[model samples]
Target: MKSKHLILIFLLIVSAKSRAQTNHQTIEVAQVDSKKNNCVEIPSTFSHEILSESKSLNALKSKKIRRVELIYTRYKENADFDQNQLNEDRMSRLNQLLPKLQIDKPEIVWIEQIGATTSTDAKNYFHGFRIYTDVAPVARTYQRTHLNDLANPAVDFLIDNTIGGTFSHPSGTQIHIPANAVIYDNGKPVFGKYTISYSEYRNAAEILFSGLPMEFKDKTGSYLFNSAGMYEIRGTKDGQTLALQKDLSIDFNCTKNEAGVNFYEMNDQTGEWNLLKSDLFSANNPNETPSAKPEIMSANSEQRIKRGVAPDNYETEGSSKVYQQLNLVYGLISSKFGVYNCDQIFRIANKTIISPKYLDVSSKKPIKNQNMICLIDKDVNASFSFGVKQITCNSQGENIFLLFTEDGEIYALKSEKDKRVNLNQKEPEFLMENITNKVKTSDDLKSYLNI
Candidate 1:
């Protein structure tokens, strides 16, 4: 009886061990399947609409995330097409269309766009793009490594037959192939560029606009962080002054409150970056149909200006805060007025600098009644009762004021002291008053500042 009992105990122990191992294996298999289904597979030959929908829908189906970041690497096409034919096509369009409707060859070519979206509750999504050359080999490696994070482009390119390799050389040939790129949101092109490198490896690059040597680098992949600003490119092409104007903002991530680059351009001479009338989705104006003579702009002029001009630093007591506030207000006003046709705010600020009404604090004193103006006063309480008051003076004695009105509107005012503003001043009058707008609540004030 003792022998039989020992045998039964041993068998029961063996059975328990077997059951434990089986459960462990089942868990391991389940984990692998979970990882596999973590990503949403994109279909080939999808339109921009379908691609966007896939991102949003796939994002929703994932685990509950507070934020989803979608990063897109712009499309990169091969240079197989005849350069001569492409140039001829541009010329053909230029010749057929009137000068006003003329377009130019997009210096930037974007393709193989890959991005990822992370979402919270699948309803709010944040998208970001990796600004890299999506060459096939690099993309393939990225795909295997970043399956759950990186987006897959609908189409991709294969490496040329010119280079073959089991491994790349330590010091390979330094080839500089022109590349084009742009940032987009919801199928709309926001920022266009000619800043990409097409080679075996991806180049982390920055953008150099036509008239600016300032290299704006992309942060957190190829997307510029806090990039909502205005950029201008103006030059004389064929003696008919040409200008490229860009108004850029970020597509705010709903969960994180972070923004990525969203760029747009205006029709030449429209003086407004109107999304409805302008091309919003194309980095190279893909939607712009009419072709114009190839625009030839040299970077030399921009370089010269950047080197020659040094910005004046206004050192004044408590004026720094005033300047900061003024900048915030300017941005807000510009955005609110973005709908209406207007000149660049900097130009307006420059014009305001020469206004005679602006106090030259270098030689003047902050007076309550001297700089104030009243457009209307119901009680005939004019003078300083409903206008600007100089609250502080900079080291150069520039007046910084707190502007207020009877209708509960208030603004911060600063005297423009840039050399360019002074040189361009034909007359000194009170144009700086444009900075003063009556707004209610600090939130309204902050909104104007775009904070």
Candidate 2:
């Protein structure tokens, strides 16, 4: 009955669109968001940078063989999730799994973002996750603790997105999901095996959830059964009563079996997902839902991390090493963690700071340095420069500096372009002897010059 109504609703929605007059410009299809328009044409400034980082990170992420970790939750979540490898042991095992499975390691890690509610307060949402690894998607063995709660409500969850294309799922998907019931941390009306249903059976896929309660509003709750054969329960003051603005945590899981492509799962807690087949998906998006791929939501999600830095689904491709360094710093600042240390790699050349005299006279100097430093490539195609207040560089250049102050004053080092040197245990030789203090109050060239 729900499926019939959903189909009718889908038909009605489509019929309404078809009935509209075609003569006028209709918002139904004529709408083009600024982001799409902007993103389509990569900003010239970031064009090279994005492509470069994209290629570099792609190489690292798109290895021929790969293994990935899947984080699942007992607190209902989606089948496919996008997450990164944070644990060193987990990462090593994944790196090794490819060879054992005779398949390439994974280019992406599928996390099963789950919802949690500790026994301490079924009403309160707890930030917790249970991790597992899907060996070439063949089988899954959980890492660390494996706890599935049936009584407590979930506070977090996920959505399995099917990237639309030739490689995507056809018609729909089927999942042979594994779930158990229990109550952790404890207060619930009852504790036993409850039925699990899929949203597809309810026809609620591609829809947004709203009108949720703030916390556990009441002792009783209602389990909403969707057209997809999945049961979604909402805790309320009463079974029939509804609470607006009350946030409820969900514990869920689902499976998606694509024809001829093997099976995959969306773990409810860990946010880790993967393919059950011995294959690597070079073209897969963990964030996009199977039914609808929303661009705005993708942009806003912190889950789309740029490698190890930003959360997967929330970032763009960049140097993973650089991002790792930044992550350490950010972690310390936001969390209770203390100061973080980062490593930087430098590229050296024959000269520490290339002198204009090293080049042949070509009328137009490849690099020009006056007040600020301009480190230009010998070919003059790429250049990087840093200054007192602003940093402007050619699209191909990478700036390795920290902007400590918003005003951009007092650099940790004399910020300049042509800075390809890294300072560590071994310091490269600099032409500092020519660094004559030229702070002349008289404002003369000689007075201002540091010889």
Candidate 3:
């Protein structure tokens, strides 16, 4: 009887250890109401180990989730690790996985907490994720119409997926896809006809209007992108998105032939740009034989012309040609379907962070949340979007500041040539001239700023 009792105790201990190892971390999904105290927690057996097949996710799929707040807990045992980087990695993994489980992209808010470290057990120290779903959606703060108008339209092309081919943009940018290179998200092969949508942001107007983020953040600090050219390409079939099983080639034409330009791709979920590869520019040949390639060139020249840094017809003599032979091309190879940019980092020296108050010219009243502020450094092909926040700018660089109102109004702060603003002062009020009637389009805005 004693031996049988000992065996029973041993079995119970083993079973408890097995359960602890299997369920190392818990993931809870809670529904949040308007009142902070009214959070109703749903019973969740969802653990990190079974995230892919969680019944908690199924419960969320039926409801309309406006925002998702991810509350993550880290134990003191991992205090040495970089919390910000770990947060980003976990958030990125969740963002990628949640969408696959039929959860649409919602506004994701991350909250970090430190867990108690009284127990030295590894399972106790394991990080956990608690998700709070907000059903009530908030109204958009900015004017989407103005942003949409400024954005460049995608150039679509239908391609045969079975036998891949090269497609050229009117700007002379060529996308070369290999045969049988397309696949669905689940690694399933895709066949038949697929549509490829491509968009390019070559110049200041294109970059500014596209509303695509050019800021790259690293461990050191945030840096702006001095782009040679930026392009977004995506593949889809019938309404489903497609991915590249292999790398596709891009013969990117650009006006600038600068060396040391690296390729970067933006994260669809986080809006973060990750550096992929670097390429050198080949020597320019005006009479060189053109491949069925596309052009990313002329933007550098066009920008220079617009900024009065270069003479008119620097690369052309009033030619109606899209692909100018005089421009340089950077051969880029990408394995993903998303936004790609060939750019160099523009480090802002002596940076100043200022929360300037915006005032209307006509009424002389302070404007808040009703306008979007943009600071453009045309020399470096860098633009910063300051939407009711502390604006950071290079104290030495000649930056152009423009305010875009909600009601389609435009205003500009007069920047004198080589006159630098005193970075020491805080809360400087900028009186801007309302140039709404003069600027009809992005081109007009660019011209007006140049003048």
Candidate 4:
């Protein structure tokens, strides 16, 4: 009887310990904060860290995240049908770069042949692919690891840069990679070549983009603690301006109350780092097709469309006139009106890429008012709005425009430099544009404007 009692007591103790440990590990489960749709939102800190980190960027944890999207673009094919060969080389190089990452072979996603007309430059067949990975965040893992809690001083320093309470906004950063420009790791406001085209990498090693220089070290793009409490690399390519970045390759894990923070060793001593267990998933603008709308753009501003130019480098006279024109429109909205409230875009789509990105503007806000917009860079990448300001990103950019009226109507057309001049430019008109009209509401906003 005594022996039996001792065995039972021991089993109970072991069971309780096992349960405690399980609870201690971090897991991301999706819980609908609002019922409009199902999405996995990163904690505010996570989004800020991820954006700031994406700036330093570029890769993630393996076990915690089981997938990633590999994206690339080519301007011209080499002489000997080498376009395919080159793509293969790049894909192989990526796999080799992330030996630990579980990614499959690359498959062609888009093949474009352009001529010198409205679109500049001609090219042979272009090939690219979206490689799925279960092991990757080459550097971003560090931030995700400490999401629930701050671990190291370096991370702590970075976390401060990420969004915080009192003030929270997306990282509207656009880093452009001009032709042959010296890729600086950390000379300007943000560190990155921003120049991530095939013309930029030039080598297999560059595919990894992790150890370029300490300047481009993204704290959030490091390592994270997986469900098993094991450390691994993982980070999603938040957005890219590849030729025309169609949309973001979204990597997400649903949550009950919305949390995807994977913990790590240097985690808080005692905090709610691992309270939930959920499955993480990945998404992207798989087959993004640019909008083919023929609309008149009264874009006459120069400051708005500058890519690769940081907030500090705004006055480059040689920047794109077209880019500046659009920027002028955006500038008008910002200066006159309030910061876009995530559901407002003052101007219509000037240019749309082939890649598709389902603009996610806080599905949780019941009465939220923010509009998002996207554009492509150099015909290879796209930029999504981080907030109101449109910054170039990984092949995709999203900006939220604010509306000053109820029923989500009335967008302000303010001008940059507080000048109330309207450049006499007509808002971008999309005609025959292959734009995707999402039927989110019973009545379409376009219908109200008779678009």
Candidate 5:
């Protein structure tokens, strides 16, 4: 009797334990069904909130409706997700599979721009387009950190962009595309490329963003996709959001007529860019070609060329006469200034001192012993002579100089075209200054002259 009782007790205990295990499994399955599946889901409440917050909807006359349609043609054909799976909790499994995937909620959305373009044509037509996106905050952060890492493909595959990559299942396969390939969000034509591959995917598409119309209240706006798979993006011409202003720092060389300096860029009459030949001053060109290129100094330190004239040969049969006039001016100035340093001499010989001032041959010779100086304009085209209250003037001819005195007498460098020098009749202008009493060394002279 005792043995039989013990056996009965053991079987009862085993039966109860088995029932408990089965109940546990059933509860687990039920819990899985109750929890959410997709990481991001937009319910009707979110849709209503977005509409109200965006203030793009109206109930009055004609309710202009804009919506984002997730053409699920590819998803239905390629994805193996069951109807139940769309609403089931897969975060636990996804977390195990992809440790990098960290975003709490990620959803597909659309960004639209109204009056996004201004016509360069005659009509000045305005156009606009829509952009689709599936980028999440966490995923954006991860991409920044691990741009080149392919180790966690699941992070990019699942949460970042569900519509991207090869979606393979028993039914069919949807090949992953470059973001640029997804140009057409719905039926509207977007401006730039929409590419989303393993390499890079920019969710925002830059169209004619600069000239968006001012009447469009929200020139650029975003809309969330409702769980029902529709996102209404309303864009109206009320008042526009300005496109971002940019301060661009771009570097470019200005057009300069430096005689011997090689100009790499030149514009023609029709405004087409052209480059002068490198061997413009080669010795081979004995024939004076009318199309003869301007002379440029060679790279050689020993050989120097100035305005098509070489150092060894100052005058040639058909060289520029401007050089001859400049040489004459240089000799006169050097003789009066007690010989400038080599650099100053080079600057003068190069015809670099704003163009040489020519004495008006028509005007009568001026009285001698007057305080005067030659002034060259910033532009090398014109020059002049000016009478001043006995102040020194530097001859570099690059910058203008000013002189002031306690007696309220102000003298400035004269840059008018008509002020000419009579090289033959008058002394060199550099020597006319009150040198003995007022002028000092070259430094003091430069300071007084204000080169």
Candidate 6:
């Protein structure tokens, strides 16, 4: 009886151990499957409608996310496309919706996976983000790491809300506000004195430093803007924001009187430029320099003038009628106070897409950690930010490429007029000349780009 009981007990113990091993294997497989399931696939093409329906974005809203891993696959065939720009655009869209969803911003980790040279499955091309709640967050590197250190300071003006008046910048830009035009965000009319902070970006260096998106999209296609000038205006009363109850007249001053330019207002949240109005350019009289003497309604107006609010480079030759004629004044009536641009749509006639390998002049090795790559079309007054692998530009336009490093270094590549790229080579090589020490200021950069 004792031997029989021992045998039964031994069998029971073996059964229990067997069951434990099986359960352990099952749990391991389940964890692997859960990780795979956490990766939500997103569409290859990005749009506002598609973004609204993103599963990953919805997960962010519903769950307590510890971290997010954005996975992008780079295919060999589309190697020349800018993957970083696409990711940035998607992130921008996500950032815009996060506030509305009342979700805290998660730490996003960008991961670039190399796809097979010949991918047969369509799923291989899909990009996505993996959400984690249980796991600890890990450090990750991002590709879109451009630093915007240069900024033009805003010129502040104190204006009476009861009696509105015109304020002018030394750059000849004017803003004409009307009485009782200021209102708070809640539609209450603001009383007493308010301050208007205004800034202007007139050149390539200013535009680049301002970090404004020059690209515009419409139903037809994407286009670049040949900016005549750009301005930012904001109203504040005792540190609280104020808005315009009525349209404020703007006389945007520029050196060039380019025709067919339109007014555009930038969406601050999305960084998208919207077309506001047309017929913006008005020929100014040769004898009149609007910016030469600004009319302000302030007790210290004379002190402001004496301080030389006008930029020295923009000083009009009071003696030369030709110089005054070159000073173009464009008109705009806007009810919104924000960043506005006077720009002409530049349609590339002959588009050339190139993936030029950037090399440092000193070491002759590949440049790493490039913060931003800018291509300025000197002929059309347009600028382009480069993608990770490819840059698209007008084949015949006079172009200059500027590559900014992470450490504030600059490298430049000037293309010869009418022959921007060599079509014969599969991968073109651009030997970038270091211009970091040369460009000390915005004016210096403008001179270097010859814009």
Candidate whose TM-score is highest: 6
> Which residue runs does candidate 3 get wrong by more than 4 Å?
1-146, 184-191, 219-221, 282-327, 405-409, 418-423, 435-441
- Provide TM-scores for the models: 0.16, 0.15, 0.59, 0.20, 0.13, 0.63
What candidate 1 gets wrong by more than 4 Å, as runs, is: 1-227, 234-261, 276-357, 362-451
Model 5, range 1-451, lDDT digits (tens) per residue? Answer: 9999999999997676444310000001000111112122222211111111112212211321121111111112225634122211222232233233233222212211121122222122111111112212221222223221321121112212222222111101111222222222233433332222111010010000010000101124311100100000111111221111111110111112122321122111111112222222234322132244333322222333433232433422221211221111010011010101110001222132221222222342322332223333342311222223221223333433322222222233333336533223222332122233333222233345433
Per-residue C-alpha lDDT of model 3 across residues 163-281, encoded as one tens digit per residue: 87665555555567778878888788887888778877777766777666778877786688888888889989889998888898876666476776767888764567898776545
Cα deviation of 260 in candidate 4 (Å)?
Answer: 35
Across 404-431, the per-residue lDDT of candidate 4 in tens digits comes to 1112222322122343222222232111
lDDT-wise, the better of 3 and 4 is 3
Regions more than 4 Å wrong, model 4: 1-59, 62-79, 103-428, 431-451
How large is the C-alpha RMSD of every model relative to the true structure? 28.1, 30.3, 11.5, 25.7, 34.4, 14.2
Q: How many residue pairs clash (N, CA or C atoms closer than 3 angstroms) in each of the candidate models, in the order given?
A: 38, 87, 12, 94, 16, 0
TM-score of 1: 0.16
lDDT of 2 by residue, 105-144 (tens): 2333323322233333212321211122322111111101
Tell how far residue 164 is off in model 6, in angstroms.
Answer: 2.5
Q: Which stretches of candidate 5 lie over 4 Å from their true place?
A: 1-252, 255-410, 413-419, 423-451
Instruction: Please give the lDDT score for candidate 6.
Output: 0.62
Q: What TM value does model 5 have?
A: 0.13
List, residue by residue over 1-451, the lDDT tens digit for candidate 1: 9999999999997676444310000000000111112233222221111222234333333222211112222222333634233323332332232122123211122122222122221112111111111111211232234221221111111122222111111111111111211222222322222221111110011010011111122222111112223322222222232221323221111111112223333332222233222212225322222233222111111211111111244122211211111111011111211112111111011112221234423434332233222211111111111113111111232333333322222234444445212323334333233332433332233344322
For candidate 3, the per-residue lDDT at 30 reads 19
Q: Give the TM-score of candidate 3.
A: 0.59
